[model samples]
Target: MPNILNLQSLLGLAVIVGACWAVSENRRAFPWKLAIGAVLVQAALVLLVFGVPGSAVVLNAITGAVDGLATATRRGTQFIFGYLAGGEQPYVVQNQPALFVFAFEVLPLILVISALSALLWHWKILKWITRGFGLLFQRTMGLGGASALAVAANIFLGMIESPIVIRAYLDKLTRSEVFLMMVVGLATVAGSTMVAYATILGPVLPNAAGHVLVASIVSAPAGILLARIIIPETPGEGGAHADYDSDLKYDSAIDAIVKGTADGLMVVLNISAVLIVFVALVALVNVMLGGFWLFDGPVTVERVLGWLFAPVAWLIGVEWSEAGRAGWLLGVKLTLTEFVAFIELGNIPAGEMSERTRMLMTYAVCGFANIGSVGITVTGLSVLMPERRQMVLDMVWKALFAGFLATLMSAAVVGALPGAVFGT
Candidate 1:
């Protein structure tokens, strides 16, 4: 079948966007022009990268680079962690399917990408790219320069470090603009984290890096649109671009690499700890819940979530048959973290879910919108703008919802994209 955007996808997009609009804070003042334009832009980018021949070639090359980087990361892991890191001359456990060595192989990529991102920033290449995108966002979205720049920085620096890019504008930003930035932060993953996810999902989805990148790009504008709807912009706000300052200056290239590596190490420890505790707690809860029987015997938290959110899964483009499983992954992502969700998605039984479901789930789970994020984003942004703490606290939950919708919007678009993009 030639991959074309069919009626099913168009309805899904409209339903999802309309749902967001329905619950908008000021529905009377919604931004109709921006919403339509953003969706059109998202559709064009999706078709271009996934459908257009010239663009797919470029996307494939980028995905190739990311895949090679993952391989390189494994090599580094082997050199440092030896057989435990999936080296040659491996023992039984070492050679096993990513069971024991999953963290060893995947988590370290955070460190590598962080250092690489820092190096790019130090050379101002990252700055130029982010600022250019910020400019586009500023003009296209009709957003304040500060918020747009921060949104662009989120592509690489993530929700936490991204606020630093617009630290100066935090105080001046109106309530609506602040919430929009928060929504964008939650909708996208940092470049470092994207590498981590790409490493895990590379085998499951074609062009993992490209999909993750596209997910962020598509969701960002959606986040802004959603935010605007939920809480319409106050009169006279988010107009004109502000002078951007990346606030990411490093003393030297080596300095960036070293600092970024150190930051990556901290993140690795953080991820390791979170996973250890979160997984254990989930098991404990499941044990209690497992006592109850469903048709399939003892039920676990995941199964319950699968059933509860199955409709959500289906609406995002998964088939009705696979909705439960996709919803399970979505639940894990929202409750635990996208990291744990992707790890679990990589382990799904082969042929249990269709290829399309797996690909859509990959896009759906590629953000930082969990409950854990609400506090992290609040604290991170608060460090720069303490005065906005009360306001951030007030809007945190709504931001999370907007972020979730934004990512799901991206997933629908990707799922609707013609499979021809992947040579399917």
Candidate 2:
């Protein structure tokens, strides 16, 4: 039997769409028809891609790519860790007391994956795919050309790099269009980071890489729908259709690899630094919260977050029993960053979370949609279009909400799926 109920999923969908509308300054001007169309198209894409037999070929192609990445990462790991790569003896003998040596040992894989993604982009592989997807968004969502391209590119590139595709249009884009770009950028994971996330969650979930990759693709339209609701586009004022005329110029394959390596190094360092600070801050908060001793028991940040967001999780179809835990992780992802949330999720005892709950959480926490991302998007966009700095700042909060709703939409779809389909 199908695990999803049409009415319930539809209601949850309405809540997300309505919430987006309610939060916008120009709520009365929302484009309900376009938003509905976008949602339907997204739903159709997910059903076709995941529900059909012929679609397996396309999925197989994606799986093959993921396997290639996993193989390369493993080989790179082996080169550094040698026979200790698997940590078989330490795990079996119980001699190593250290709980997080593997995290440090595998850190180099982040750089490797980032470099590989850069090479793929330079080779025009990712760009071709993104352009095709961009065209689809343009047709279905009626987005301005530059905005469509940026949203599509976001499926594969980082928040900053995707905007560079629409650099020429940045200054001319309307407030709504610019807000859509920022929201989409925050709503999806970059191709490079997807590989790193796969590695982080792989131990706990089957098909980890594929799920993360799929989540970003599925979230694109959701982002569009939410952005439209948050800041309705004024048809005559928005810029023309997007064109990614900016070719990724590289001298040679070797040159691409060298530059990509440097880019990846910066990303690795950034992730490491952010994680250290965020995790420590969470710990500090927990210590303070523990002192509360409400009801003669210690309260922690996790508990507070769980209480705050459990309703949202429940709205997305998580079981009541598991909603609090799922809510806590979602809150962490939104308030801090997805990287911090994933680390916590990864360390959670497997027995405490069901496969379905964890799967939903995986989709929920898959984006860079956090408080920090709002500033990143504004700064990045402002750099490309100095004249629009004020506009970017004006729409920052709208983009943040849109980005959050986009990820929630993705989780809602995942939650609505039959557990048998995803092997949950």
Query: Largest TM-score belongs to which candidate?
Result: 1
Which structure among the candidates has the greatest lDDT?
1
* Whole-model lDDT per candidate: 0.82, 0.77
User: How well does candidate 2 score on lDDT at residue 152?
Assistant: 89
- By TM-score, how accurate is candidate 1? 0.94
Give a tens-digit lDDT track for model 1, residues 190-277. Answer: 8888877877777767677787788777778888888888988878765535687756679999999999999888888878988899
- In model 2, residue pairs whose N, Cα or C atoms come closer than 3 Å (at least 3 residues apart or on different chains), thus clashing, are 145-241, 145-242, 146-242
In candidate 1, position 3 carries an lDDT of: 36
> Can you give the lDDT of residue 295 in candidate 1?
86
Stretch of 10 with least lDDT, candidate 1: 1-10
* lDDT, candidate 2, 75-169, per-residue tens: 77667675465433434545453533544444666677767767877888877887888888887888777878888899988899888777766
Clashes of each: 2, 3
